[model samples]
Target: MDRAGERSPWPWSTVRRVLATGGVMIAIAGKLLAHDPSATITWNREVSRIVYERCASCHHPGGTSFSLMTYQDAQPRAAAIKASVLSRRMPPWGAVKGFGDFRDDKSLTQEQISLVTAWVEGGAPRGNNPNALPPAPKFGEPRREEIPTSGLAVSGDLTIDRPITVDGLWPEHVPPGASMQIVAAWQNGRVEPLLWLYEYNDSYRHPFRFRRAIEIPAGTTIRGVPRDAKIVLMTADDNSWFSRLRALFRKTG
Candidate 1:
């Protein structure tokens, strides 16, 4: 999930713009290392290693967007790279940081980000140890799929039907042959489908943090639905999405 902090709105609409192996140990040098006033930060020693650990998964050939697998590919995209990371727009995990310890959270740390900034700002050097780069990340699971599912309107509202924002949903387990989507009913009485999760995997599951967090005002009616399963909404710990999730589980469990 992307961490919440003050950030100028990313102009990704303006057109701009990895996986870590080795058990998260050195997948990256992590701290961005104590800055060496004279140490050279080159592609081999630092930059490409960072790229492989955090970016290569989706950026590789035949993956999703264009490739960032090589320095050649990443060099030209330096500006866009800096924009996405600094804006916290890429590595799209929707949960806000400092709230939950999400597995595979690809959001870059401040130091890591600083490293990137330095690299891009200083000409993105390709230094020694190109071959020292670790194996790039790869995910065997399907990144996406379309599945038949019911919309939130499909299930009648049980509460007072007043406006309320959707933050999280849970089943504890979505067994084999089980999958679902968590749809959001907007505050304006309009229904817009939010998350459509298929082949439901908990490790990959994340709460939907609204870009513009919707607050359901009293008297505004809305609804939710459960498709082939029990679906519950979380409405606590406004500051921490998953913290609210844990509390929800405690109450129901």
Candidate 2:
């Protein structure tokens, strides 16, 4: 008789079943590691703020595009939103990052973009707290009066004829789709980056207001503008005779 303590070895079929189960478990673990668990990110907490501040300008109801002003409106489009932000296609600001500092910039930061991606990948959950949502942004009609009347429009390369303080640049005439990089080369060989337009769409034209006014002395050459494209230098000296004359021409001619 066989010893009582001795037991029969496991069958080959049993070992194969165990191996298959382990493989499935490993695959599931790999998938989890591939994406953010998105355990903390939620529509009410973080995403709503980002969308309102950066996107609501054009995406709110009765605005330029479809409404992303509410969680219900945004949840369904989470995937598309993620793609747009990742590709830098939304917010519609054409200026490249790190080239110049501008106020009222609508472009999302890398961290903000990642948060959006994770929120989408994690199933776009609306958090438990509805109160976490920020206040809605106020929309207003475009102020045509605020647009500067006194400025110099330059089509090609231009050398500064006199010392002037530049406040900002407005892309006065950008082709439907064009890429241009404009720079200011100083007399001392310092090249300051002004603006870079990539695949610019003229329909959404707006002035790029600098963080602070830049004082450009005489002899600085504004270069890199395409002969076909025109950008206006919005200067601080609105009382200059040249500016007054140009404004007069714009009104009359």
**What would the per-residue lDDT of candidate 2 be over residues 1-253, giving only the tens digit for each residue?**
1378765487778888999999999999888865445456889888999998898888887787899998899999998999999988887887888987798778899889988998898899999988888889989884352666667777778777667777889987888879888888898999988899888886448888899888887777888888788788888665653644333222110
Off by over 4 Å in 1: 1-38, 137-142, 145-253
**What is the alpha-carbon lDDT for the whole of candidate 1?**
0.54
What TM-score, over all chains together, does every model reach?
0.46, 0.76
Once model 2 is optimally superposed onto the true structure by TM-score, how far is the C-alpha of residue 236 displaced, in angstroms? 2.4
* CA deviation > 4 Å runs, candidate 2: 1-38, 138-145, 239-253
lDDT of each: 0.54, 0.81
Q: How far is candidate 2 from the true structure (C-alpha RMSD, Å)?
A: 11.2
TM-score, structure 1 vs. true: 0.46
Q: Clash pairs of candidate 2? A: none
Candidate 2, residue 140: Cα displacement in angstroms equals: 5.0
Worst 10 residues of 2 by lDDT: 244-253
